[model samples]
Target: MRCSWLLLLPLLAACNSTPSAVNEGTVSRVADRQGRDTTTALPAPDTAATKAVSAVSDTLRVARERHNFSHAEGPSDLFRLVFRGPSILEGNAEFTITSPEGQVIFREMLTEPDLEAALVYEMKTPTATRAERETFVLRRIDRFFLPAQFHTPALDAKAGFPTDIANLERPTWDDLRKRPDAIGFEYLKGKEDRQRIAWSPLKKQVVRVQ
Candidate 1:
């Protein structure tokens, strides 16, 4: 009777283990299918946020390339020289002045590219005297001075003096109009020189010698 029970016990254990193994295999297959379906159902990624960030970056880049300068009220006799331009994304710049008497009065080198980049030089000479003849020179002190890269030329051809114009000849309105690069300079000739000179690119008008 004991031998017969031992053989029966082995068959009973086999029957119990086979059902659990089969159930476990079926559960694993169902879980794997559900996981795959969940992965497939996920929505596609949106690109709107990426595009917005790109557009903002382009606007900032364009703004950085633009530069301007102006002079307002100051000392009555002294003339104030104001220079403003885009800070180079890379590299440096130097500003210098050569007096009418062939003297180097002032010089400064700017290495801070993160700043707006401007220079102000005040001279003791009467505005009337210095107004007669003054030369301001801006030189690029960096190795890579590609005007096109910065999108702002080192010298604004329109606002800067022309190299071809002889010092003896006074630039006329017609002459300036012909050269788009010539910057209009207004000065008092006798009594009428107090009037301001204006140039509007948008309006396509040049009020010379105002």
Candidate 2:
């Protein structure tokens, strides 16, 4: 009887152990499957914002490149003046000359290659009666600078008069006297005589008496 009881106890214990083992196995398999599903179900990383920023940056770069290319291909005329000197005494100057008919004849700025520089400008005039009057106008335009001022007498003297006066047609001085707009000069000065020179609508060579 004792042996029979022992055998029954062993069978009962086995029955209980079998159910626990099955439950544990089922729970472990379910947990592993759930972990795999969780990993697989995650959405892929989104790169929309990064891609958008990169696109914008690329667009800006392309626009700048186009702008640089267009500027390089644009039409342009370059005029440059270089000055070498110590301290300039006179300031820079600029001037504009207008005809009696209010036409812009000449405009220029003058700067010293070195010391005190100035701009001298002469405009086409209608005609003048007395050359002195023309000289006065020129003087006024030059701001009455003794050095920069040039009168018809000075011009005549310089050209040796009657000899080099090519376009010597007597102008309608009366009209110029009434209008005084035949020829004119303008000088721009800063503090003294240093200034930059700018010329617009530059005419062909007038006198070549260098």
The Cα local distance difference test for each model comes to: 0.32, 0.30
TM-score of 2: 0.21
Listed per model in order, the count of residue pairs whose N, CA or C atoms clash below 3 Å is: 4, 20
How close to the true structure is residue 144 of candidate 2, measured as C-alpha lDDT? 33
Best of the candidates, TM-score = 2
- State how far residue 79 of model 1 sits from its true place (Å): 22
C-alpha RMSD of candidate 2 = 22.4
Error of 2 at 210 (Å): 6.0
Instruction: List candidate 1 stretches off by more than 4 Å.
Output: 1-41, 51-121, 124-195, 198-204
Candidate 1 lDDT over 47-145, as tens digits, reads 767743332221111111111211112211111222344423433333333333344333444443312221122334544232222121222222112
| The best candidate in terms of lDDT | 1
- Candidate 2 yields a Cα-based lDDT of 0.30
Task: Name the 10 consecutive residues with the lowest summed lDDT in model 1.
Answer: 58-67
Question: Which lDDT tens digits does candidate 2 get at residues 161-199?
Answer: 233434332232222223211222222343354222112
Clashes by residue pair, model 1: 157-181, 158-181, 158-183, 188-193
